[model samples]
Target: MTHRRRPNDRLRTLLKEADWTQEALARAVNTLGAEIGCPLRYDRTAVAHWLSGTRPRHPVPQLAAEALSRRIGRPVTPEAAGFPVPWREPAGEDPVTGFAALCRSDAETGSRLVLQQRPYRVADARAPSPPALPEIPAQRPAADRDPASPGPPQAGAGGPELAALHDAARFFAASIDTHGGRHARSALSTYLADDVTPLLTAPRPSPSRREMLGAAARLAFLLGRMYEDGQLHGLAQRYYTYAHRLASEGGDRATWSLVIRAMSAQAQRLGHLSSALQMGDAAARAAQGLAPSQQSYVQAQFAVILAQTGERRGALSALATAERAAEHAACGQGGSPFDTYPRAALLFQTSQVLEALGDLPGAIGALRRSAAERAEADVRGRTLTHARFGQMLLRTGRLDEACAAWRRFLSGRERLRSGDAERALREMRRALRPYRNRRCAAELLALSVPLTEHS
Candidate 1:
């Protein structure tokens, strides 16, 4: 059979421009991948495959472009590598079916082979995002929902109401903070399949339809959060995308902005700072007409991106705006049942910005305040705060104080399932490496064994 697809002419041209052979290019790509901690062991054979139009998965394509760009002394993109840009999925498609299918597959197969690469956090220049969804639907009159339905809604008369579905989601959300996502992910997934998905398609009177949409929208967001907590970033991204569309369908502008902002958060996790910044800016704009609480949340998120990008002035400005919005929002609705951004949340965010800006003392002060008043249910959040505080202390040569903070974090065994917790433990060991022979270091290392096991 004749090979008919276009050869990677662009890649070939770039290789010639850089004065390199296929083997040379493969070595460069693998070298760059290792530097970034991605183990892309592409050989000359792999390069031959790509040149024949076989697409490489994510960061490899990205890594290849970077390698060529550096070699040629010019910017190179995945498109320039004769590869489709990494992860150019149509963004505006209805994500429910895809999202639900993924949830079920993960739950059943126990193997997430479909998510071969983590979703890209930021948009690329090649393919455009899907056409934007229209304005949020107008809120219609809603029946007072019954918030106590323990089971899936019944089909007809006197059936469990939409409010119960919403409430059940809320119950799971409440447990997530204290118990960690791994602790509750199975139950949340089951709820999504059994309780939430059914009501989403269940026939409802037009009057009660608004409430159902709202409940489903919230459930999608909560599921996304749970996925994030469990470090399943790709799945979280999908759920957030679906939730945003659902919010638009229901005219839930408040949550629509939050969901968009959530995608930004996931992008930040993936270290796509610029992409996260773009998402945050868009979310802040979309949230302008929303409640102060919503504005507060987005502003803090924008600050995080700014901080990561080294925009100190911009970050501080956004942080102040977030504080003002948080105050105003506190005077109003106080919190969303779907997510929270209390004072402690703001303080923790401030520490991150300050830390990024190299104000270690200022970061420590903010973290101390955050830890002092963190909410009880925010177990993972508090654990992170403790870990950060400890890391900072250890970095500053205050070993004993750092040990205290690590102890505080380790005490929360329930939160150990999170990747963040594991990183914190690693940081502690690395920090204590110099004093490895010290009694305190040995004690600290011993206490962290259980953490390593869980992590």
Candidate 2:
């Protein structure tokens, strides 16, 4: 005779079926929290609550679904686990609270004690899905130009203090480009909180405040990108949030688009496919009236997120649309914030999408084009593209090519401290595992040892 399963028994059954340990579950939950911009560090006790039939708050249920799905090797909806459904409020209705609340709730519940007690699976983090979009458009052409330019600097020339802030921001951005995200994230964040934040929040703000606000927004966005690249998603989310708010205050559509892009990245990383899609859609709409290049770029980024979610068809469609927009902008057929949308950047994005979709040959071809078009002076772009190419080559079993690519990538990144490059090295080591005894593999391994040490 069989007995009915108790509430906790259901939890145990789920864990057993998923084959995850409590610590593993906790780690997955923490990762999910980070993806949504709500940094959470949970212990085992939090997992206990869910098994007892106590519902986690709003966003937690969705996160739990994501965490659970990874372990089960199937999609797990919130309803499957007896949780409330996810909701998306219309845009322009309390934008800050609507977005922030969703992220916060998801983070809290995903990291709750009840769920963390269950066993977790690391493979869940890398589950195959759609590819992410690669086109990020400049929101405002004027903002994109040097602030010191003659045609009425977006923010007036009178405020020496504002000028100084712009200089400082440029200095930080240059450091990030020269070094890697790992080298720059902490310092950038410190500067924002310690130096930039005070200036923005100073008493008796000026009417020309939009310029200062825009500057802060850009700084925050870059900092968030660096953090995200460094795998510090939780911290990145906070910075994105701060930037988004600043953008709203400035009423700058371009900055707003940047915020959406940052949010989309977070959603995709966290396994929130629907939320990620929604963010991209929102961004596209917000950028619709902008110049063709800007619109195309935004659309491309949307495509990247879609690809990451395993929406290959949608990703391709979006890519095509972005290309057309870019062409139109280049021909001066329509207004574009910038006259030229780096065609090479679009190619690089396509390569990334192809790589994610397991089209190794296609990825390789695209990468080749991207490499050819990329200028040597664009060190950051070159380092990133080469690292990606190396990773894809290793995945496709082109061990020699992978090694060579890594060598080039490492040489370019050597002058800079790069977390992404370090990750590429680790990936190369893992890929070389199958051929450990081969001479080429041995050579690659020897080269990676120092990379690991530095990382």
Candidate 3:
């Protein structure tokens, strides 16, 4: 005899609360599925089957949950939607161990942690306060230590080992900037899991341990960017959370602030405006008493967050504060990526604020200056900047000039494998579609189509 399936009461309840018909829910789910490149043709019958306790395959459950979440204006996890639990950051685990496990899982081909996309929860934006640092023991002589114990040598603790880790982090960071994360992510993941995690978990003197932790935090932050470049946002968020823990434990308040601000920026990009504002505020608070450059960086991002939330006056106020802080900030500190706040970045933030506040002309001007000031080494930044500049130019009816800007973007885009770059190509195609009658628009549209299709 066959066992009968129970109806998904939880999903039915959610459907009722959302006041959506079966067809509407199915349409929403299908739309989301397409957005993630997992095309679906679910119709009302599919929704009806789901309500009758028929579960779908991998990612369909997630897409359905996200569709419901968007409709209800809150997070709805797969489990809440009467499906199996999706991969999430292991709750209540030690951050270092959890980070290690996450890296290991991601390194494995086709692991769920890397394959599944978890819906962004607005509530998770207000992360828990940093854990208190573990007490450190007195330094012991090398002769007294166990040969089997895992750790760096005392003689080379803060010297060679730390420098080597710093150098590795810089190389990975630069590689990501120049080629996008696709080219270097696998090797980076292997290095983090096989090398950095051991140094983090091993017993060491406080100073050296803290330095190692700081370096690990930066590397984790880079890993998050790599995941983000691949459009695995949930994985990226988990990495960012781990990075924050590492920075906090290491007493690196500046890096902690930077990571938090990066989270804010991610939230903003994903349309979680309220969550973005909250995270931005936390980043500003965390930046207190840090270097002027760090403060300016935090404040500039906070201003964009405020503007996006429609707080015009507050956005301008925060921008002013950021400007004042920048006056005292020295450029090119030649330290960690978080150590310096360059004029180019500030101007880019300024453009974001201005565009959000309905000053398109001002935004365009700031964006041009930003593109000019940006370092030549930042290929990804240059590509994205040019794409954005072209979009703005198109918005202002400068068709020929916009085409020129987008041509520059395409030149750099060939060297990268970035989700943002892909999205820019799609956006260019869409924007130029209406003007296909014009010679310039037709040329650029033709140029963008192949790229968008390949992506």
Candidate 4:
């Protein structure tokens, strides 16, 4: 059921920037696709289709972007390479690009609600069930850059000299948590490609080399996070793979384990249950004898993946271990959340796992803890947590309480930029469709109306 995708101006702009003819671009896409074992025998006619709004399938767009990125000597995402999801951005530096791009969508939804002036239909026992979350595409790990290629800027970085890189990554990461990833992700990606990559390849003393490696790993991890926050799953997976390789080579086992755990979470999120379990197991094994907090963090990831894989007994057992370890780490122990992951992140993962296991009340309890554990710097995350909780409550028939949770979500206007939040709101509205006449449902709709219309 592939809908015809609309043509976009983005590709034309990219072609001008790359100085490539349509035929050449199409050839490049075919070549890249062949390299990845996905033979797309596209030609100029294919390119014409693309230009005429015929959006190609998933990895084809990614391959085309990579082909262009290689030609331009800069990272070119699918959006940049002329394949954005038909959400045309309003012109010029509009910070709220996501909202603007979907303004017409909002308008259409409003019009579809034809009873604006009349009493709307209320809840019906057989009203359509809320749609299940869509299956997110599993991200494929990309090959690392060829060592011979001198990225964009001259590739000469020292070890200790990279402390600034680490600091900058940390700062931007914090900024992303506070301001959302829309604008900041590109900034960080540019910095990584232009400044850090070269420095990473430069000569350095042993100690400085180790320092540089650590910084590189951290920056790469944050880069992955930025991509993930932006919903660029393929790019995020590649960046995470780079970070994992860096950590492994640098003997940063702690970081390596953390990366593995993070990979597991991403895999699970994208519905690769078996791969998630394997990655989680690797993380748990790698963290053996590490600080209780770090081990606790790894085990927590293990529990979630285990539950996802239907290993109920093992999941619960792992969770218990994580609990005890977390408590021990909290008692002035060696487990710093900064060095590993936040102790409360486990709780958030746990809530999802519990929900998967059909423990409704238990999931709510974990969600509450997860909300409380979010750092103040994590503005968007807190909002997401509340929104998810509200959705869960709505599903479980707690309309008033769900509204209360959604109110908290609606309050975080500035920090809520990820389109995931928007989609979650859409789902919430769908759930409310049946109960439209209820006071709480009406209130929820009123609150969200402005978000879509004016975000």
Query: In TM-score terms, which candidate is top?
Result: 3
The superposed Cα distance between candidate 1 and the true structure at residue 228, in angstroms, equals: 2.2
Off by over 4 Å in 1: 1-93, 110-113, 116-160, 205-207, 331-336, 414-416
Ranking by lDDT: 3, 1, 4, 2
* Pairs in clash, predicted candidate 4: 5-53, 6-53, 7-53, 123-434, 155-198, 156-198, 156-199, 157-199
- lDDT per model vs. reference: 0.68, 0.62, 0.79, 0.64
Residue-wise lDDT of candidate 2 within 71-153, one digit each (tens)?
68687666776664445323453433443333333236344232222222223222112122222226436455422211122
> Under the 3 Å rule for N, CA and C atoms, how many clashes does model 3 have?
0
lDDT (C-alpha) at residue 7 in model 4: 72
Taking all chains together, the TM-score of candidate 1 against the true structure is: 0.74
Could you give candidate 3's per-residue lDDT for residues 211-257 as a string of tens digits?
78878888899988887777667667778888988888777666777
After superposition on all C-alphas, the RMSD of every candidate to the true structure, in Å, is 6.6, 9.6, 5.8, 16.2
Scanning candidate 3 in windows of ten residues, the lowest lDDT window is: 145-154
lDDT per residue (tens digit) for residues 307-394 in model 4: 8788899999899988887887776442122344565577887897798788989999999888888988788778788888888887
lDDT for model 1 comes to 0.68
